[model samples]
Target: MRVPVLNPNYLLTSVLFVLFGSFDCSELDMDGEISLRLEHSLDMGKSWQDRGSLSFSKARSAIPTVNQGPLSDENLSTLENLCSKNMFYLIKVTGDGIGELQSYTPACTMLDSSLAEQITLFLDWRGNPVAANLASRIGVVGHKVTAGKFDTRVQIQSMENGPTPDTAAYIQKMEEEKSRKMSGEKPDNRSFFAKYWMYIVPLCFILLINSAGAPENGGR
Candidate 1:
């Protein structure tokens, strides 16, 4: 068998380059500080630049906003600081007391060549909207993913903060919906077929099959 020709020094250099370039930083920020870090990248994620970090604790306490109301200018400004006036951002919720760190890096699409464009991070709570205005202002999308001891749930919503004069009206709307749902008001505007389309569609198919299987007879 013929032996393959190879350059030893070149291979060693290539290995060293890969080892150096593939390295990453996994260190978190400081302890006990729940915060959102805004970052962006050019050249298709070959490199990145951190804009800044906005503390959740600071923002929540700084604003007098309750569970329901429009997004305050103060709070908006707090989030705006994270972007450093940039239109696009990569949001990362850092700090302590947060359970299992998980991340989602979506594939770059034709609509969005850069993953950092319109990146949204949602911290879901019982009565509050999941940071809607912050997302809209900084160009981010939404989702809630939780890992339980024995279960997991994921909920995704639009980045829209709703109509003007009420940038966070959806919070109030959600509360109202929860009230309606708790009061036994089901959103059953769908027709019987629509409501049970899964069963109805398969059942219709079965009926059609049976009818087709039956011999066709015309009265003589």
Candidate 2:
């Protein structure tokens, strides 16, 4: 497979951690350790099952806020290993002072090196600033990872068809970004082939070849 560099819009603070932020985000705790629980939803949010818990050595914010730059890589490699799955993942954080912060809703994999690249954030659906403020009680100083390239741009999921203020804002933001890129307001310095070769090369060498050649003759 043709390898491509990390998405310019998607920021990987450290070689290990990938971060996304937006208007509605997660709360951070400064004291004590926080327990990160993973909830799996094969059919969107219809049914959620308790998968496992992610334990941070110290308190941290699961979501990145406005003032919060790029989230550092605390245990990204470990998370990639443990959090590898095709189903949708809902990351929830629970700890002292902070009851529960529904942090990340993402399609996660250790092999993002090959997965389709799109920088998106899960916006705030709860609209609970009180929760956010309560969440803010836990500071993100030493607890949160802070050792990678900082990226703070997130596009909303327009294709998913969710009706919410955060989603609406995200869609608008994505449209604006697209317009800007088209109008040269935002320049793309990356090569076209690097970004697209992986998708193209396979069709020519594998799929097309398989279709053109004779069938595998009784599973060869």
* Index of the highest-lDDT prediction: 2
lDDT of 2 by residue, 42-145 (tens): 34445555544433332224432222232225434433434465433333333444454443333342123212122232222221111210011122223322
lDDT tens digits, residues 168-208, model 1? Answer: 34235446755897999976465644543443354345435
**Least accurate stretch of 10 residues (summed lDDT) in model 2?**
128-137
After aligning candidate 2 to the native by TM-score, how far in Å is the CA of 82 from where it should be?
20
Runs of candidate 2 with Cα error greater than 4 angstroms are 1-31, 59-89, 95-97, 103-220
Report lDDT (CA) for all predictions. 0.32, 0.33
Q: Return the number of clashes found in candidate 2.
A: 10
